[model samples]
Target: MTPRQPEGEALPGAGVLPEQTSAASSSGRERPFSVYLHVPYCRVRCGYCDFNTYTNLAMGGGASAGDYVDTLAGELRLARAAMDRAALPPRAPQTVFVGGGTPTMLPAGDLAGMLTLVRDTWGLAPGAEVTTEANPETVDERYLAALAKAGFTRVSFGMQSAVPHVLRTLDRTHTPARVPQVVAWAREAGLETSLDLIYGTPGETMDDWRRSLETAVEIGPDHLSAYALVIEEGTRMWAQVRRGELPLPTDDDEAAKYELADALLNRAGYEWYEISNWARPGHECVHNQAYWRDWDWWGAGPGAHSHLGDVRLWNTKHPVAWAGRVAAGRLPVAGHEILDAESRELERVMLGIRTREGLELAGLARLGPHGPEPTTAHGTPARLVPVVGRLVGEGLLEGAAAMAGRAVLTLRGRLMADTVTRGLID
Candidate 1:
């Protein structure tokens, strides 16, 4: 998805964001802070993925894997110094997530050392959730053990599909058998496990999807995230679709797959906590929750986005460019936007409605540009009550939840979540 445009003027230069200092300075009690470290290296790029990543370790200008950790350390130090300069209270990171093309593509030692850097720089909060995204083919039993020994508590594998043809279509390197092995190894190493799956691939059949889900259920990871395939523009899959080499996935096809996934996962004892994620009771991902719940996080590495209260900042997309700025004692911030109240409310509504907890009815009052007053008996904004009623009447939202002053989505609503988001926002 395209990033929400910055409401404020673009950053003056590639240095620190102009609003960063003020956003930090005016901070009151520290909110939950998390750190995201992006490892941009990949053994091979998936055809459908558009993440900022590189397969060439030999990319010069301090972007090679040999010195990646060191270069990233420079940015972390700069981040801490920036925080100190702005008198921001030093809060231990509640969670640390390492995501990438495949973070495990780096040596286990590199991943461990980076985790050490984060811990030493700002101590980890007690029981902090430390996670890294791993590709099944890139890691082994020994590698997972090393990461666990270095304080990594969770591992999310990119097990996009269990069917051979589906994997081939996505350009995924790992075979179907590798997922169970890595998941078992992560379990043995005392780390929580999560699996990510994608549905609605070009040539995927209903039986293929069902088989994948059954295999995943049998593997039984702590958490499962089944995302519908999205063919982003400029990606290889997008090009194929444009050329008619691959059929574009229809909304109906995707919606059916989504419904099947929910039913299968739910039968397997996983409950939906968010639109795309399910967990076994308390195994919900803390770092994922941090984003949906609007926690303050600093995203380090190329092209990662960070948010501090109303301010959102992102790094330069290219690793070489990111490294050069860090080497020059700069923040490598490409640009930032300070969110207005309306943008903030829109975001709150958009993100909150996706979760199972949903949003409180009273909160909708502040979503308007002019901040309308609550006029309903239960304090829902007067204008929004009819919209909620219409959605409830249409079976898109749960009528009981609406009466209880919460805007929770029914199964149908979850499938048409964007519609609900727009109705509430508009």
Candidate 2:
């Protein structure tokens, strides 16, 4: 269940704590939460990217990046102060994740400065997991070592495909050879390493998908995240599809590749802990887990989103606007909504079902009694139960009998998840 603040009291920073509130002592009563920083600058924009990112050209040839960083540091200070006023006791962040257009795009010194700010403002917990996402082309032994020294214990590299043609089609600039070298560099630098892969591209075949999986596993990352390509509107890929320049896979074809990935990765000793994320035991992303479990997390950077208790908020998506607001000594908040109980519950279900831990059955039971086997707009609850049941029968789920008492998806349910979850909650 979502935690509630006392009625008639204003929430911290309008229900979002600033950086100061994130100090080690103010971590609240529960296990300390996580932190996510979005670095919205990229060297080149990919055709498929729908994230809030700007090309390097917009960074003003690196001349304005330092200014942006200074502004970010100032924002952090203000955030810390806001957190303090919120009255949340000091608590060290459990995990810190720096994700991006590409965090590696930042100069090593800039990256170090970001980490230092985090330490000074939030106070990293002892043994805190600090992770940074990088593109393969930008990582090297020197860069990897620098990141390790700066307190990044983990590195996630975008190794979307090992095939050169596929990489070209996706507008990724890295070569297949670059990925393993970077992985080796990261491991030698004493950082846990993970690689991301995308499958079911427009012209990608099942064989190609399998080859990509095999190559990624052979590179030996501690974690892997394989995602099926989604054609998001407003992206270059979507435009290509409209112009008949690319043909997407049929549902059956995509399903075949998904099944192949699951079979291969599971046999290769990776756990499918989430729909798209696979990790070796003890290597699951703690920061991401905080998000899946609905724990409080703070985001800083243009277009970053934060969820604190029942409130969800986002910063200005426009980099210029964000920078201008921060320069003016005001929080760059764009908009926010206080999520109601039902909305929060639904969000928990959607996110939880995507993970291996599934939803907590006991907690769901406490949410309220079943509503005559509640049916969503899509279908009857009874029909949905069997979809879950079949997954358990297939050994993709555990604790099925207990699930009848609580609506949770099995691992197989996670694989064919959209259908089952849509049926349950519409």
Candidate 3:
């Protein structure tokens, strides 16, 4: 089925499909899919954030948020048409994630309208996981109720730390008091709650990290994401550190804090599904899992990315350019690429190693000639065999059925996961 081009429309740039394309399933069978919508506006930019985002870029002076939403709706329509043409069966998206600078920065009505477009175009499945990233300071009773009514089942808040000093150091505006209140309000509104916490800040002590973890557990969020602070190039935080105005923890200290997080959250009944993410049983972020599992998900809005099997496409990063192209009845895509086998294998290892599930031994072997042997038959690599043997000997990793054939990370392994994964992939 070809998408009906609107009157006076022109074809988009190189490699961009014209608002629709044939969707022939590689397996000739229907597959489950997910959707991701990027809301790139934030009330204020955090010093450490490197996401493609605009601060105070709402409806004024050339930045018309209304126009942006309209363009998003157009993109949604094009995406649906593309799927329909592909001959892929019409299945409701298993998950929908609205991540941003801060999705809550948009007016509640505007945000609701965007979600409505998604539901109307893609058709949400019953019990589909719909999540939005919200700021703690933006969570009010009214906004929470509105979001729930709009079909959001999960809400992730950026509560970097529970201490005022830590927050200030992060240049975050919200008070720690707002964390519990937001979680309570979201829970009351019938949405599962998740919180993002940052550890290993310059001045953070073990006690400080412990307090943050304890407070998060006390609030009882369904999910928690604890990330170590990294100073990315071109970020204000990096510049400040270069000038010695701000300091970050050394790698060893950060590793210790990561270990501390594992101890606290695991004791609190949270499972570390991925390196930076934990959740209570059955509360994992389905949308994020889709990415880690390498499932096909459509991304909309500026700087968004989509992958259908091996082909990955991304939209223009500039919101204005994206909207203008869609307004002209063209797909707003900026670039696309079809990944080769080696690239896919590398990506799989990169993503897979970060999760509780290590790389599939058989799949890795099939990827190339240099792949390692299955742990079941030959155990770990020759270089690491002695190390694994010693670790097992010391009672670090359990040799159970769940971990029977895989070199899975133990709680201790998770702390030094990057180093271990590097050795394995190398």
| Pairwise TM-score winner, candidates 2 and 3 | 3
Q: Judged by TM-score, which candidate is best?
A: 1
lDDT of 2 at 381: 53
Report lDDT (Cα) of residue 86, candidate 1: 57
Per-residue alpha-carbon lDDT of model 1 for 139-210, expressed as tens digits? 999999999999999999999899999999999999999999999999999999999999999999999999
lDDT of each: 0.88, 0.75, 0.76
TM-score for each model = 0.94, 0.86, 0.86
By lDDT, highest first, what's the ranking?
1, 3, 2
lDDT of 2 by residue, 1-426 (tens): 111212322334433443333223212445456778888878888998888887753554222555656777877776676667767666678898898788788887788888898888889899999999999888789999998998889999999998888888899999899999999999999999999899878898777888899999899999999888887887898899999999975777877877788889999999888888889999998887888876777788887876665666677776777777777776766766676667766787788777776654333322236444454333325445565565566655565433644444554566666665554454
Position 184, candidate 1: lDDT: 96
Candidate 1's C-alpha runs over 4 A off are: 1-29, 366-372
- RMSD of every prediction: 2.7, 6.3, 6.0
How many residue pairs clash in model 1?
A: 0
Q: Which regions of candidate 3 are displaced past 4 Å?
A: 1-31, 59-63, 85-89, 367-403
In model 1, what are the clashing residue pairs, if there are any?
none
Q: What's the alpha carbon RMSD for model 1?
A: 2.7
